[model samples]
Target: MSLEKLDLASPDLVNENIEKIAALFPNCVTESSKGKAIDFDLLKQELSDSVVEGNKERYRLEWPGKREAIVTANLPTTKTLRPVREDSVDFDNTENLYIEGDNLEVLKLLQESYLNKIKMIYIDPPYNTGKDFIYKDNFSKDEEKELLESGQTDEYKNRLITNPDTAGRYHSDWLSMMYSRLKLARNLLTQDGAVFVSIDENENHNLRKICDEIFGERNFVAELIWQKKTGSSDAKNIATITEYVIIYSKEITSLAFNQDEDAHDNARYKYKDEYYEERGPFYYDNLDRGTLGYHESLDYGIPTPNGGLAFPNGRTKKLNDGWRWKWGKKKLEWGLNNGFIEVQESSSKDCGWGVYYKIYLNVDNEGNPKKRSSPYKNIIQGILNTHASNEAKDLFNRTGIFSNPKPTNLIYNLLKIGSNENDILLDFFSGSASSAQAVLKANSEDNFRRKYIQVQIPEPTDDKSDAFKEGYNSICEIGKERIRRAAKKIKEETKADIDYGFRVYRLDESNMQDVYYKPQEYDQGQLDAFADNVKPDRTSDDLLAQVMIDWGLPLSLKIERIDIKGKEVFKVAENSLYACFDKGIDEEFAKEIANDSPLRIVFKDSGFKNDTAKTNVKQLLKQLSPETEMKVI
Candidate 1:
């Protein structure tokens, strides 16, 4: 039996949406010339409670390139990630990933492996300051001089098409760029996940509108004000100092962030008792409290230290009370039996006693320590932009390597709020790799591991900058070096055991040749001209990586190169998948792999001796590893 060829491509969003719609309303789905499609007229009628109005005026955000941007999100990319072993810290073991590529294409490739897996996403994208370039520039294969002359890139071939105010479609272009990426990003968030975006005044309002449309207005969490600086002296009317960090949850009902850390004066809690070991320390307060209402049950008396009866505020009579004991009668008795209530002697009063209660520093409620946390405030301060620049300088040991890098503390704070032990954190527009440093630091502090995936475009640096002078030619180079250096520093200072390694993968064209995808357009003789389906320079590692992505397996999974009787084979995540692309295979090789019993396996079609050998190999696997799903390239 001829094995099925593995479909090496990203998830087709259009088809996935059709299947989802069909599951809800089957009659709204219909067959189109291309494939399965949603019948819009039927879908519209099914969604409406009354007669469907096809073209009524409604509230919706629109732009010139909106339609094209929506199409881009639904389309699959022809690119794949190729592993970079030399740059990777721990390629074989680490769960963290540092991907280098255009984030739009990278987001598409990750749609399958990371669908509903990422717990938190924090992106600091281009703020659209008219001088800043957007990420929508498409790179072409022209010469460097030609690209520079056409204003598509800079001297270093950096994708730097600026969107100045003079351009007619200024906001439209920015919206289109953000709209498509946000649409793709939402699918990757877990049910309890959320995304945070930072923006300045230049495009804050526009970004809010886009996020509202994408994440739904009801799911909007908070517009946190980050005091980026002390003040901007260059401002004409008012000094600008704050920026907005908009947040939205995937499902508002399911998500809940951690409360802020405890903020209290330790000195106040000074007194101690026998229970101080668990309760920390204590302070005393008057036992009597003014009543909000006249509850006669609460107005009770207590026996003093001098063997005297002490009523509420030393009142002997049960007058219509404006005062009462803070605790109820049962709770007051429990406190008296415990070491919580304090009765002291007085000179003049007939009761001759003072009643007070002990409050513990670490609260002891029914013999349990209360959780130490407070509601987090929406206004963030003190972490300034200068701190971010200073961090870059400290890490690089040189100035001007990067400008306006986000402070690692900011991400550390976000990690506390949004992540827990072993939760996945992602930052697509990772600059200077501060988020990676933050995750590493957070893990070290608590010894709770959290895996992170960072994505960035390799935008080149200016020649005059200190980063370029130090041989860091691109932003990705600086970002990667930051992680390496930061990991060492964190390990030395903190002496905390944590995972400080990450796998590196660079985006590139697919490993397959043109004929592999377009065999129908070529004659059999023309197809015969190509020696193999894969490209000439591609290696077994390259094919394995792409195959894992196509099979919806993570790139960070543990991969082992097992030698099966001189044939090179890759066993991913201990038999979740097994692949051998080497040639010269027979039933003996298939039987060896079948003995291990992998859940899924793939091989090169040309690996077998002949058609007869391929048929026997499948038959052997059927008898030995019946559960294995076999495919070929």
Candidate 2:
């Protein structure tokens, strides 16, 4: 009856993938240092038709750090997201999330809850333009303090070296950074989901190949050419006015992109019908369509004005040639009776008479209201950098705050195409949170409650930058403020009752003490000092947040705190989980919670009076709610 300790760490993506593979092909699974891992050689043999040999030439997007990137993606992070209630907006009820941290670690943390849950992903990562950016192509851990002392890395350990084209690993390092993120991002997509990545001329081709490798070549949706400016004098030879938004679907079979509803050709519906209000207009098409191989049943005649039946192609029933009625016998009868058929005297001597069936412009024969939509074009224009700057000016009443953050309109367009009602959208490289505002704006117009998660690294802003001067010390601050300002502006303008708030969480080290993860590394005296597995600085809220993540519960889920016998208890998403972190947790509290039949239960191990008390609490829950999964931290 001993309660198991909750790992309370980011999911081990490598182990999870191996377990998945093991479930499909059990023979490929083997023991490794990590325990329960895939034997790649065995897996290859299982998958291949012939013997798999040494490194063979194959088509793939490779880079110097590709192996490291893949390893980094598979590595488990001990980082956990702690709720920043002070920085949050409507922390208790809001569906949106604004996570602050390095996106790589943040992506790893999110893997547990958000896997296959996001409907759309939009990212505007650092464009690697050899300017102010992080993750420099050149650096070493051994020179870390020396590098920082010499102004190489920032306080947050973000390498701030200029990665010019002359650098040995310019493209390789950028690709390495992007490859791991994209690898993790691909798992967060729903089957019908797609990712839209914004890039310039420098890396669009490389990104295309990378996406093709990750999302599969067949899942490549489109390379949308967005006109960022009318023209740019900064360009040397050809004006670099355009950029690209490359899209790739999670699964090609499930991906069905939306179309432009307003762009349909309205003029084509020139003719009206009795069903105009329901089905709109009507146009006639020949009922007797000529066929290469006519069926005998389709060659039958329709009743004419002369009381004699008119055969197909003026045939006298005895003669035959390849011709058939577009509508079947039953449909022809129904169409004629329902005012859907039109009969007229023939212009040609061959047929002599003609029969036409009305083609409704909007709805089908069943009369369900249908939409005529124009295909979403690959070329996006009119959404420009000036609009984005104007938006910054309008929001902050200043220009050059974010150096041309994406216009909300651009992401709004993407949302319309890739997502709809109640769908979740994510942006890992969420600078200025344009994607967040887009979700809010779209929901207001469409009345669809589309939620979003915005993850941004708190990259420090330049001292001379307007954003830094305006009291926004970092890009995270700018992003948070933009959402706040944009929410107010959009709400006032539209007066829409949409979610205008987000829960803020900052990524940090796990809430557990080091001895909890590695007891072997600590001495008996050190272990004695760490009787409480949880970190001293961490709060009950922090513990709850980590437990929620480790339990694979989304951060957006509703949490209700209630006091049971002078002890605080958190009930997440109505019986999804129940946790009590207060001291002196006894059978009395356990029985009360067990009555509600929670799917999962957690308690701080130190909360119990002793080991016997912990056993008693576990036994109490078992008798009351046998299905409840008990865990401790």
Candidate 3:
């Protein structure tokens, strides 16, 4: 989630491809004294405060910590959540995604591939109701820190059921879990994006404060209230029906919410009965009292079109206060001619003698739809058992995957109000895949291309439940089934040919080269560099792809490979990026490549045969192509 600033022209950047770098960081680049380049350090500092320019100024930075700390030993956790084989569940190319793993680890892994790409985040984490399990999330143990320092991905550890009802420390566990996850989720949000968290009364207040701390209090949006259930016929101590959704943005004012349309439902605008007279069925009050250009002398003796003297109460005098009719006399007369205005006869003392205007039912001009304000009411009638049951039935064929599922209508309305069709939606606590289903359904119905990423832990199912009896073995299984069925139903209904498929990315041990962790000195004489016995599981090409994802590079970015002398070199089309991860590269190879003028060129630290040769290569490349960037992978 850290934002790093980059300088395409810096010596650290081996690639001198200015055009390609500009394309990668479209808005972050500026015309500096040298040329088009990025301010990497400034970008990193802004992330600590806020991102700017519609999320375009944001970039991923290295994790913060002491750079020279000693490495520690590593150990494996005794308790781990295992994943079941999902061979049976079918996943089409749907935009919705679901993963089973600890969300913190998943977020770290995703940082290499989906950083700063997500636009919206929504989660319904456990309310810490004394029974809830707060993930222990201690990733850097002393031993693990050593392993990471020596180059390795750390295995995480977690704990459950630590919230004690009377410990007065009950809020501590929930706050810790939420704080870490919110920090990670904030990284995932686009600069012009936000997050919404659903919670009951128990921890809503506590969660709001933590969110404010992470996203900044200035970015806090509205706290939406949703009625979770209908009122019961038999009540005890008052039924708890509503829940709250606390919202915040990565950058204030970047995200947009739909303004409500005003309601012009007034009974005075309705006609009583028609056909009684040419004026039609009309109700009238004093028009002259609030009319424009009124004089006290002209108040009582004014003439009506019907040849009747205007009543005393129908005063044409202007009041000291700013009271006046909205329309002028010509407009009032036009309304009378159009049978919309009328004069009341024999009006009682309290009813007054002023003329009233009849605003017709389907004929009045309502103001802009965007001018409406959101209504705050305690009861939301849309929440009912039938609604929940029907949504569950549609996703799981009435088997009822989970009992405490939120109504789709609730999430649906929130998405409509707080997000756009093209926004990226996320659900870190995706139980029963309700949020995923809601996103697919919403997109298909609205002809929008909204995307979603859902994360779930493959927690085992209860043996006594129907899901267990029906061969549904785990929560993740139920989630996969729900997504499968939802996609099929949406395709059948919409008949729209779209990529409903998701790129299946599973979390595993890093696909990095093992040689990256070997000791500096190896074997008898130590003539050759030490390399891992396991060989490299991830190639340099793979690392390049991972970096692309980390830097918020598009998946479809064009890349090409060229052969210089006897070595294979990669060229990124848009950035004019040249990467040489190959080892034992000589000066002739570097010079020949530099002759073609690459804007940026990256070589492996182990690529050049010697330090003198490496220095010569950089010097030659710089002299030949002055604007080219050079770096070592």
Q: Please list the Cα RMSD from the true structure of every candidate, rounded to 1 decimal place.
A: 15.1, 15.4, 20.0
Better of 1 and 3 by lDDT: 1
> Residue 14, candidate 1: how far off, in angstroms?
0.7
- Per-residue alpha-carbon lDDT of model 2 for 441-501, expressed as tens digits? 8888766789999998788888998788888889989999899999999988976668999
- Clash total of candidate 3: 33
Candidate 2: clashing pairs of residues:
none
In order, candidate lDDTs are 0.83, 0.83, 0.58
Winner on TM-score between 2 and 3 is 2
Error in Å for residue 107 of model 2: 0.8
- Candidate 3 ranges beyond 4 A from true positions: 1-97, 109-117, 139-168, 231-236, 260-381, 468-474, 513-545, 554-633
RMSD of 1: 15.1
lDDT of 1 by residue, 461-549 (tens): 77988888899888899999999999988987875668888999988888988877778899989888776688989999889989988
True-structure lDDT of candidate 3: 0.58
Please give, for residues 123-236, the per-residue lDDT of candidate 3 as tens digits: 888887787656644445565555445433323322333466675656765666677667767867888788988888898877777677678889998787766666766657
Residue 15 of model 2 has an lDDT of 76
